[model samples]
Target: MQIKVSTKYLKTSSKKMQPIVSLIKGKKVEEAINQLKFLPKKGGRFLLKSLESGVANARHNFNLPSQDLIVKEVLIGEGPMLKRWTPKALGSATPFRKRTSHLTIILETKPGIEIKKEIVKKEKVEELPIVEEVKKETKVVKEEKLKKPEEPEISKRVFDVRRVASGRHKQNLDRLRRKEKGGIIGRIFRRKAGDK
Candidate 1:
């Protein structure tokens, strides 16, 4: 089984973090921690903490020995950029973007250790046949009755006219109405020409 952990929105750019994380890729957990401890970059410190967190998670949750664990993968991804403005000469401003990164580390057991497999057993269920009881019927004579007139028709479902008439349909309906009855501007121009 493999253990995975992630740290997001670290205050470091992917360009700066890639080189530091490459140093510990595929190394043993303890060795990686040791290498990160001596590094001068802040990204190394954060990465060390994230690796330790993964080790602790494996040890406490999975009962896996830390000695057999090795770093399998290191993934660094770009996160959201924060945009700001810096003052420039001649009454202008320049845009400044601060970059962020997300890091994920995967760890797995060393080679030659037999992995345990779990077997799932399904139980058989027996179904019994259902038997329904029959009832006896008696016959009787029927009498004729006069029928009344049918009532007015009513629909079973209703649709909203407002929803259908919204958006582009509404705009098209307005355009058609304006075309049928010339328009306010046309009437105004005609009245001015008649007066002239």
Candidate 2:
């Protein structure tokens, strides 16, 4: 069985991904993953994610072992270009494209291998007893809740009104203190050299 996985619109150019893809094509899944883990390129990370996704799909969905899987194909294609402009000297703008790439990896088991799917059989469940237990538990919970007293609801507006009233009173007191210290002209004339 062949498993294919794709990553779309990676923020890199196809040219940047070419070397990484070429290095892993036709290699075993384990070898490709190891090489990708140590590669020092940004594109390597993107390709590695695609390869791992393909390998995981094969192992989990098809019950194929990673050791038996090989990288059959690696494809990198150009994606949409993000157009941007930079300021130029002569009141003109220099336009550029931020390139993107799409990567796809195909993994297949080695030749002479056949996939066998395992079937799981579910046993019959006794649901009537479970339903009766849930009903009894719910009744006990309702009785416990009925025995508790309800809490009184506090009004948030009362606290908010008090806070606002205290703030205004403080502001008025500050204004009166400034007036008692005489007007701005009196305060400035009487001010010490070190005082504002």
Candidate 3:
């Protein structure tokens, strides 16, 4: 196993890279490369470059192919601070402390041993037991109804059946017909011209 570091001091770099570095440590070379390709961190890119260099070193110095590269460990540590000054209110100045980091990557290769071609075992696509997805009828999630002006009480009034049944909507017409007149009770549920 050989450990190598890209930067002696990362004093101005982001500390956010520690978690990602920890995630890839001890992972396979291929997986680490893929993860570092799109990871969204400033130090991650630099750390990836260093890790790749270590991997390359294993390949070239040890006379081994890429498949033999394995990340043994990764180390992250705090680096020297870069002091900065910022303008503050009331014509004063504020001293700002900028943080940096240092990263070390270690890799190892198996020696004097032959490794078979990596047979990528495909994850058995679990045949979902042919789940006959019962075609769910189209569903409409109902939203809240708008607040409308309250109708007059008209508690004692009785409504005529002939006035309500301007049947544009069949369901509304059937509902009005089923609700026969019961004096005040009937008037409370009367249909207007816009009911349909």
Q: Per-prediction TM-score, please?
A: 0.57, 0.67, 0.52
Clashing pairs in 1: none
What lDDT is reached at residue 66 by model 3?
58
Candidate 2: segments with Cα more than 4 A from true spot: 128-196
Ranked candidates, highest TM-score first: 2, 1, 3
What does the lDDT read for residue 156 in candidate 3? 52
By TM-score, how accurate is candidate 1? 0.57
Sort the predicted structures by lDDT, highest score first: 2, 1, 3
Q: Which candidate is the best by lDDT?
A: 2
- For each candidate, the alpha-carbon lDDT, in order, equals 0.84, 0.87, 0.68
Pairwise lDDT winner, candidates 1 and 3: 1
Tens-place lDDT per residue, model 2, 111-187, is 99999888889999867545788889999999998897889998767554425865755645767888887877886
User: Candidate 3 has what TM-score?
Assistant: 0.52
Error (Å) of candidate 1 at residue 119 is 14
